[model samples]
Target: MLLTTVLIADFEKAGRATCQRLLQLEKKIKVVGEARCGLEAMTAAAKLKPRVLLLDPSGVEGEGVYLVSTILEKSPKTRIILLSERASDADILDALSQGALGYLAKPALASYLTKAVRAVAAGEAWVPRRMVGRLIDQLAPGQA
Candidate 1:
């Protein structure tokens, strides 16, 4: 099986540890690098060019959404998955708007997180099921 490499950008020690532990259970996923800040994340992305980047932008230096765009600019092919405690609809929309392929609320189940990573690596978008309606509403207002 082809491995899906992942780079994690989370400042909290526990957050990174939790992600590492949960992702390790999946044989197809490999953790390539970890970054504690946005600059490190950008450098890692440019250097490693991992298939997926699991980022918690809240811990980064600049605005979360801006960081998303910056990272993509440097590593356009690297798929980003935003894992944040902020799950508000607006936050989810902003993340998606900024080019994140996946958005998962923090404390997400390992199954869901790994599934999201796999799906994003395969070039599919992953977001909370409830947000689908909101996204559709925004995309086609008053149509559906």
Candidate 2:
């Protein structure tokens, strides 16, 4: 059964396109609402109580992680996926530290994003392959 409700929080034309693509995959993901900013994302989370929150790191406020934290607090069951154009290690870690379940780059394929959503919905964490080395370097500076 597809029980995942996806809420997208992005403030760009690409964001809207992403939403449209997700809508096309309606059977796999149910998009409950869309928000153009982190603050609005929080409000939507509270109201929709979606299973997945597809958040863009470059939203209205410069504090997307903080917004993720708020969403977690407001809706403990909601899983946050930080979607962004940049794949910096700092960005990925910060979002993970803030309780985000996954991170994906902007140009990421819709299938990849959908896979992340399914994994997150099933209580798994995801970090994109392109940023894996960067993430490893940050997590274990001397180990790699």
Local distance difference test, per candidate?
Answer: 0.90, 0.80
- Candidate 2 residue-wise lDDT, 1-144, digit = tens: 766898888888678676658656658677878887767888899999999888886865666677778889988889998888785677788888889989887677465877888889999988976666766777789665
Residue range 4-27, candidate 1, lDDT tens digits: 999999989888898999999989
- Pairs of residues at least 3 apart in sequence or in different chains that clash in candidate 2: none
Q: Counting only residues 3 or more apart in sequence or on different chains, how many pairs clash (N, Cα, C under 3 Å) in candidate 1?
A: 0
| Best-performing candidate as measured by lDDT | 1
Clashing pairs in 1: none
